[model samples]
Target: MEVVVVTLAYTLTGRDTEIVSQLRTVSDTLQTAPGLTHLRSYRGRQKGGAYALFLCTWDSENSWRKAQEQYSPHKLLQEAHKRQELLVIDPLQWVMHYVWGYTRPLAAPTLAAIHLMSAPPEQEVLLQNGWRRTLQHHVQEPALAYAFLAHSTTPTTDEAHEGPVTVLFCFFSWSSQMERDLFYSEKQIRTMHAFSEQGSSVQILALEPL
Candidate 1:
C-alpha cells in the first residue's frame, strides 16, 4: 500500500511569487528523500494559494516516519512557515494522510483530466448536476481516498488550449490492481457509458509527480 500527503497553503495578497519559490525549494528537497516517490505543487488561480501533493511508497507508516525524521526538508518547511506568517494574511495549512489498505501501490504517476468542451457556457451547470454526483458516489467506495472540486481564476499556459471556464481535479487512491480493476469494471465504466450518452466532451491525462 502507498500513502498520500496533501498540504494546502494560502499566501498573503502580494507574496505569491515568494511563497511559490519557497515551495519549489521544499519540493526540490523532497525529491531526494527516501520513501518519497512523487512530489508536485499547484497554485490556485484566483487567490494565489498553493497545494502540494506527495506520493510516498513506504514499507509501512513506520518507514515513512523514519524518513520524515531524517529529512531536512521537513524542518526547512517549518522555518518557511514561520516566515510565511509575516507575509500571509490568514494562511491555511492542512495535511491529510491516506493509505490504500487493499493490496497494491496506488496507480503510478496518477491520472488527470482536462476537459475542453464545446458548450463552454453550459458546462458548469451540466457538470454540477450530473458529473459531480457520479464522482461523489465513485469516491465513496473503499478504494478511493477523497475527491473534491476547486475553482481557479488562473489562466491556462496557452489561451488556445482553453475552452471550458473551470477545471475539475479528482484524486483517487487504490489498494491493489484488483481493486482498481473492479472499480473500473463495476462502476467507472458504467458511469462513462452514461456520461457519454450525455455528449460531454472531456480530456483526460495520466500524470507523474517529480
Candidate 2:
C-alpha cells in the first residue's frame, strides 16, 4: 500500500470557533471519500491557525491518480474549498508527501514519527533532544525511510482542542507488519518510551497507505 499525506496550513481571519466548525465539515466529507484512509485536522496551538492533515491510501500511484480524477467533480469538495477561503488568510497550496509500502519494495521501509508536546515552556531543549535521539539513534531499523519534525509558531489558536506546543512528524517504510512489530518492540523503541514520559502528553498512531 502507498499513500499521499497532504497537509494544509491556514491562518484564520476571524474567531477560532467558526473556523474549526468549517474544518470539521471538511473532515467529515473527506472521511467518506473512496481513496481516503485517514483524515486528521489540527489547530495550531502556538500559532493561531488551522492545519489539515489527510492520508489518501492507494494500491499504487496510478490508483491515487484515478481517485483524484474522481474527486475533482465532487460537489462536497467544491463547497468545502469555498468555505476554506473564508477562514484562511492566504491561498491554499496542497503539499504532498509520499509513502511507499514495504511489502512491494522489500528493500525499503516506511516509518513515521509524530510527536505532540504540551508542557513547561522551558522544556524546549528537552523536546529537541528527544526528537534527535529517537529519529537518529533509536530507530535503527535498516528499512527506515524518512523522518521530519514540525512545529507551529506563536498565536496558538484553538481549533477542536487546544493545539500542542509542538508536533514532530516522521515517516518510515517497512516490508511487512511483522517487521514493523519487531521494530516497535526493539530496545530503541523502549528508550523512546522512556524519553516520552517527560512530556505532559503524547499521541501515536499507526497508519497504512491507501
Candidate 3:
C-alpha cells in the first residue's frame, strides 16, 4: 500500500520561524526522491506557540522502504545535528509522528480534518472494521469529494489513553463550508459513533494546505 507520513509539531515555544525553515530545508530533497507523489507543509498556531504539519505521500510501502536505503551516515549525522538545534531552540516542544495508509489521494482538496485519539490494543480489529464500514457507506455522498481513513503502524503509544494510540486522519473536501458541516453533521449521527466508540478521547484538527 501507499504510505502517507503525517507529522505534527506543537508547543514549539517561540522558534516557529527557524523550525519551519529548517524543516523545509531538510525536506526539499524528497521532491526528487523516487515514489514521492506529493509533499506539503502547513502552519497554524494555538496557545503554546506555533504548529506545523507535514504530509508526505509515497507510491507504495516498497517504494518508501527502497528510498530509505539511500540515507547515508553523513546524511543521518546532519539530520541528527538539525534535531539537536531544534532541541536547543525549544526544549519543551512535543511532536506526534505516524505513517498511515494512503488509500486515496487528494485532488485539489480545500478543507481537511485530522482525528487524533488513542484506543485499547484489543480494539484494533474493531476500529479497522469501523473504518471499512464507514468508508463503504460514505462513498456515494455527493458533498464529500474525497475521503481517506488511515491508521498508524508499528508505533504504539499510551499518551492519550490506557492502551495503544491510533491516529485516524480524515482529509475531506466540499464545495462550501455549509456542505462540509452538513456532511459531518450527518456522519456524526451515523458512523462517528461506530468508530469513535473504540477510542477514549478525540481531537479534530482543521487544516489548510500551505
TM-score of each: 0.41, 0.44, 0.68
lDDT string for model 1 (30-59, tens) is 777787765554444343433333333344
Candidate 3: residue 17 Cα off by (Å): 5.8
| lDDT of model 1 at position 167 | 32
lDDT of 1 at 24: 76
Clashes of 1: 3
Q: Which regions of candidate 3 are displaced past 4 Å? A: 11-27, 47-49, 69-107, 163-166, 187-198
Residue 7 displacement in candidate 2 (angstroms): 4.6
Error of 3 at 142 (Å): 2.9
lDDT of 2 by residue, 117-142 (tens): 43443453466566566656644444
Q: Identify the superior model by TM-score, candidate 1 or candidate 3.
A: 3
Worst 10 residues of 2 by lDDT: 94-103
Residue 24 displacement in candidate 3 (angstroms): 4.1
Task: Identify the superior model by TM-score, candidate 2 or candidate 3.
Answer: 3
- Candidate 1 residue runs with Cα over 4 Å from true position: 47-59, 70-75, 83-210
